[model samples]
Target: MDLNLKDKKALIFGSTGGIGRSIAEALIKEGASVYINGRTIEKCKAIAQEIGAAGFYAGDLTQKGIAANITGQMITDHKGIDILVTNTGGPKKGSFLEVDLEQWESDFQSLWLSVVESLQKALPAMSAQKFGRVLLITSLAAKEPLPGLTTSNGLRAGLAGLVRSISNEYAKDGITLNLILPGYTNTDRLKALNLSEEKVKEMIPAGRLGEPEELADLATFLASPKAGYITGQSIAIDGGVLKGH
Candidate 1:
């Protein structure tokens, strides 16, 4: 499986660490000209050099206009992007009623609105080129609600609808849009939660946490020309944590 990604230009958000960093590394290995992005310039720069990325972009996605600005800058500088991946940290963990009112707006701004803005700026260019791959790195909470993740559950599900709507409209343009749902992946973010790995493993049929590289490989494949026919779909890369399709 060549994946046929060599020479393609890719821009990935939240690539400084965790799943995003792993995906960027995978794309570079597949020969894509990858651009790493994060809120911290030094971190993104260091990671870009460490992974042999083509470049780096720094901006806080939670702020309005930042994503669009980054996309616009990327297009102007690199001509156009063939693969675009949007990912960010999840909102603070809390149950529905326990979350503060202001937190909802902040979550929407970072987790959802930023993606909307980036796509609005990039999709037209992709349509013109008649070649593109758009991947939204969401969570398994999109399909199944998780305790203490009410914000993620709500916004991630909304992204599924967004992917379906946009994919249908753009497929004729040679652009594919889809979601990759990661469940209990072994990453620093998951480790920071302070949850017992044994307890978590017990809940999953596979009896283990997914590796970051495993999810990264799935994303790399989806971002390649090989996955052109697979669009408007949500694929989960969990360790059989999701009981239903």
Candidate 2:
């Protein structure tokens, strides 16, 4: 199946490693011109070199104005981007009672506001071209709240709502917006939780943690020209961990 992604320009945030890196690799395999982002210039450039990315940006999206800066630079360098993948590191884990105002503000900026800012910066160009794909790499916590991820659960849920509302407004402009809710993916973030593989497998019907590349494949398809009709939906790649309809 041809994704028709050849030469399509993509800008993916948090692409230096992990699931973000996997998605970048998948897009590259489809012959898309990919731009990766990281917080450090040296690291971002190194990953770009390793993956043969079209370019890379060094910016912290948690900081105000950084998303606009990166997207503005992309527009100048590549004319316009065809695909935008919004991803970032997850917030600190804590129970609702343990979370505070400071943590809430920080997490909101990092996980929620950054995505909104990036989309604002990138949407005009996409609307003008009448073609775009916006894929958000959220987590299953957004739908089925996790035990200790109060910040992520709240912010990601807000983001899911935002995606659904905007997707309706943009579908007519030939742009699709959707979210990917990953569950127990094999990544550094998951490892940091110190979850025993055996224990995690027992919880999942698939009896194993999902591979990053597996999620990447679904993400690439969502960002493809062929998935224009699929939007305003939160699709889970969780090995049946979620039981609700």
Candidate 3:
């Protein structure tokens, strides 16, 4: 299946590791000119070199407005990006009582606003060109709340509203925007959670944690020219873990 991505330029955030890195690898494999992002220049460049990415950008999106600036630079330097995939790091973990107002605000700035700012900068150029693909990599927590993840549960779900509303505005311009909500994937982040695989597998009907490549393949297809008709939608790549309609 040709994704029709031979020369599309893609900028991926949080590409140093985990699911982000998997998506980056998939894009490059499909012949996209990929640029990766990380917080540190040395790590970003090293990953770019190892992965054969076209370049790297350094920015900590937790800080306010940094994503906007990064996208602005991409537009200025490369005349706008054809595909943008932004994956924000998980927010501070806490239960409802454990999280305070300050924590909520912090999550808003880090998880929510960062992606918004990046899209703000890139969407215009895409509209002008009449072509673009935007993929937001969130978590299954966005749909089904997990224990001790109050921030992720609340803020990530908010992104669904953002995608639905904003995607409608740009659909006529040939740009597709969607959310990729992942469940327990086999990544260092999941390993760090120290979850009992036996228990988690009991919950997921698929009987195991997902692989990064599985999620990445879906992302690659969505970002392709062939997926232009799919937009304003939030698709869960969870192993039948999400039961909502």
Each candidate's number of clashing pairs is 0, 0, 0
lDDT for residue 78 in candidate 3, whole number 0-100: 82
Q: How far is candidate 2 from the true structure (C-alpha RMSD, Å)?
A: 0.9
Model 2 misplacement above 4 A: none
Candidate 2: give the clashing pairs.
none
> What's model 1's overall lDDT?
0.92
lDDT of each structure?
0.92, 0.92, 0.90
Q: Give the range of the ten consecutive residues with the poorest summed lDDT in model 3.
A: 86-95
Candidate 1 residue-wise lDDT, 1-245, digit = tens: 88899989999999989999999999999999999899999999898999999999999988989999999999999999899999987678998888988999889989999999999989999999999999999999999998888999999999999999999899999999999999999888898777988999999989889998999999988898889899999999888888767
lDDT of 2 at 16: 95
Q: Single out the weakest 10-residue window by summed lDDT for candidate 1.
A: 236-245
Tally clashes: model 3: 0
Write the residue-wise lDDT of candidate 2 on 16-104 in tens digits.
99899999999999999999998999999999999999899889977977888898789789999899998988788888889999988
Q: Write the per-residue lDDT of candidate 3 for residues 110-134, one digit (tens) a residue.
A: 7898998999899999999999999
